[model samples]
Target: MGEIDTERQKLNCFRMRELGATVVPVKSGSRTLKDAVNEALRDWVTNIRTTHYIIGSAVGPHPFPDIVRDLQSVIGNEARAQMLNQTSGEFGHPTFTNGPGRLPDLVVACVGGGSNAIGMFNAFLEDKEVRIIGVEAGGEHGPWLPDGSDTDKHSATLTKGTVGVLHGSRTYLLQSPDGQIKETHSISAGLDYPGVGPQHASLKACGRVEYVFATDQQALDAMRTVSRKEGIVPALEPSHALHQTMEFAKSLPKDKIVLVNLCGRGDKDMLHVAKARGVVIDTDVKLNKTDFAQQ
Candidate 1:
């Protein structure tokens, strides 16, 4: 799966259990997505005859990358067809008679593990004219800093990490001197990662795709903006996309057509956000830094 979120995984497990699915807790490593994936892989290897490994992201083993790309192409295909239909209706010209169709001028998506961006970009990969922008969380480190200037405090790995193997793919990773995975932190839990998808790394290397950083403040502000303007409380991940979109809109021509992925909802982050804002949760409980840290 994408950079696994332990917080989301707990909620997923609870929901699965409620649906009568047997949930096996994987207790190893950091007891996070990486560990859970390793445990699942072991189980799949031992029970290949009966077990299924539900791979996430488009960068897994051979068939998985192709399979996921094909599956994700539907989003682009449908979107293309829909946009064509809308354009034809608006311009009063049938699709075929209107000559070659115009591709979307711009496509934007937030990249956590990069599945959605891959899926969306796959739709227009051959177009050669459309621009694809992937928004990544800037983490604690500010953007545009020179490489190696970043201390080990932030998790904006895509911009600062080295190429390596992570999760089931060869990608970019944040590692220590001995190559051990380093801990990462982000205000947006979804975009908090120690690595990026291999596809994204390759694209970045080739300059086929452009990556932008949306800081926590930008994402939080975008979240509030969308909530007020569109009445949509977007997930923190996609809020990053919105942040980029707003920036693009300001710089680009007005006629440019920009499509963005909203990704998921934001309900899961309320507690984390409330705590960050010092909203005084659990008023009956009080503790010093040592006790708080222990908890």
Candidate 2:
């Protein structure tokens, strides 16, 4: 049903296994999100007759990003409607909570092939007063230069990559002149991708939106900060947005409203987070041998 490699994702694969789902493991590259995506596509080709491949990101073949964007637009629609609703409350308007916009002055989401970010931004695109931001994985460094003079260990595609075709879509991708996709890294498996959705590329190019990055450490720290302040544990991906949100919000008055999409739960990331912190989590919960067998 899915391809996973990180010990954290492996644990979830095991859980899905208990439900009798066929989960595959991708063992190449960084053994992270990118490898898993490749394995899943291979599996789809092998069982074309009986399988329907639904990818998680807003990337891949044309119409795929558009399709997923439509499906996920509910996130944006609801956020917009809710903001309007809040404005009708006791304060008589959101001005006391945010800036002059009927919608949020700023909306932020982490971009991994950009599904979540696009989903949260679609409804606000026409609202020029509402600014949207997409945050990319900063990997080892947020904005690493690729001139051979700086270390290359980040997935800040919009912030650092060049245009290239990838997964049937022309978008910003980390690639060489030979058109080979380069390896991407991110502590968040979800954001470990070299190519981003084409629409995200368009949005950035036309200046309809802004793109930024949060380093692995920055995301992790945001995860910890949100957990402590809001009692909510967020996945590493969207923690990038939170990191940016906290940074910007702190400089503004209490009246300003900044929305950060807390996209996923942190439950799937505990093992990885612990490992990153040099904490060894010794869990040997075994499952059937065939649970991880390729389909």
Candidate 3:
């Protein structure tokens, strides 16, 4: 769901059709989700009698944004309720609260397309005291600035992007000097993106959400750490989020409660992991810089 690039969305649509679902192909904006959205709208106009376009992210038309937010609200709502129930039962009161049932002091989630982060942050948005942190992939390193410097090649869009349209919503985008959209790449395919959702941009601007990055190595380490320690193989995207937790754990109180969104399973990334480790799939070999330089 990262940035809703047209190619990936089209593939997803194809898969849906393969699964025996009725599918109407939409090819319109970036010819991705944005275009799909436009097509859905056209379908609604022409076949208003029977069409339902499922909005995926937190940004869109009024009812859509609101609907998505409400749907995602379940995450925070459930986490808070579960925390209350568990802590109250254990300590005769909720630890997050001074006494009986209470709320959490912090919330965190990994963001790519940002729906999960938005969902987790929504419940805590009203509580001025609760801190929300959104973790993103560190595409590359450069000078420090929340808005990012010209030297940055990273795609932590919420912290370093400009207002623009991508995937059907006005949002923060990673664009080239010519204003063309630049494709984003990452070891974690799920986090690869050139932009962030509009809602996340606004939240970052308003200081309600703090953005951070986890490098590829750090994410990989976290993936390994979780597998070794908890016997759980987390998706690489959420491993990026888990990396942040490990970073924070180093400085915070040992007992601090940290929750990570283990977004998806890791079955899809075996090939990627193998590739990253230099496990060659084909016998094709290329000469290195040293060989060329010597020649």
Candidate 4:
């Protein structure tokens, strides 16, 4: 099950259809990642004998987080090897000076459910000299409504959340005073989750990794910057990390290297990015309202 009205859902719907997979768009609750996870859990529970559930991020209970992280660690392993294998001055980036067998001065990645960041950081965890950072979504500033309610305008779980149990895991969560989970906001659908992985919570507790945040505007600006300077349109998820990377890189010396996990492609984000930039994308294909009606 996927959230309705998300670029991820829209893109995945087409891909899943092509791959002969049925698409179920969850329209209930907040109609977001949390609701979709709820629906998926419900479905899995009902079909326990026949269905196997696979979580998308490094979250969920017990072995699931460990399984996801171990699988995703290939990203860090490959990146580390690639960087070490490159000869001196082979990496075109001016920041990379002492090329072969040299470890990066810093490593960074965005943290939503924390899979990608954990995967990227795992290889460098033992390297005491390497600095690691995880960037979260600093959506909008939440203000109290006249009705005495609060609007949850951020998804910076590690940076702002309190200890809570979510999805069968003890982790940091965006919650109310009474311990109710709060709805979160982010321009990136992937980073809009209210709870982070338990591993991240543990890391934060031990101070192994430093968690920070990048505002929606910062991510949008970074996306634009990458497009203009690097000729690559980065997905909003990675754009958060890129924003932090840019700021951190500015403070480092020319010889210090920073590696950012630019994970997702920006194909699905073109329309969203254009809309955010106040530019309308004219498309011959139109989506009918009935197409998204609750099943």
For lDDT, the strongest prediction is 4
**What C-alpha lDDT values do all the predictions have?**
0.71, 0.82, 0.67, 0.84
RMSD of 4: 6.5
- In model 3, how many backbone clashes occur? 1
Models, CA RMSD each: 7.7, 6.2, 9.9, 6.5
Q: Point out where model 2 deviates above 4 Å.
A: 1-4, 86-101, 145-148, 285-295
Candidate 2 per-residue lDDT, tens place, 155-264, comes to: 88898889988777889988777888787778888888898999999999999999989999999999998999989999988998899888888787897778778899
Per-candidate TM-score against the hidden true structure: 0.79, 0.86, 0.71, 0.87
Q: Write the per-residue lDDT of candidate 1 for residues 1-295, one digit (tens) a residue.
A: 3223545444555566789987665566645445555677788889999988775656555566667766776676656655555434332334433322456788899887677777887767677888989888886554444674665555566777787777667877878767899876667756766777677888898988888887877888898899899988888788889999999989888777888878777766655556556775563566789997997
TM-score of 3: 0.71
lDDT of 3 by residue, 24-90 (tens): 5444433344344556666677987787767666655556666777788777666765656644432
Error of 1 at 239 (Å): 1.2
Model 1 compared with the native: what TM-score? Answer: 0.79
Candidate 4 runs further than 4 Å off = 5-9, 86-99, 142-151, 286-295
| Candidate 3: regions farther than 4 A off | 1-51, 59-62, 86-102, 140-153, 280-295
Q: Which of the two, 1 or 4, has more lDDT?
A: 4
Q: Candidate 3, 123: how far from true, in Å?
A: 1.2
| Per-candidate clashes, comma-separated | 0, 2, 1, 0
Please give the TM-score that candidate 4 achieves against the real structure.
Answer: 0.87
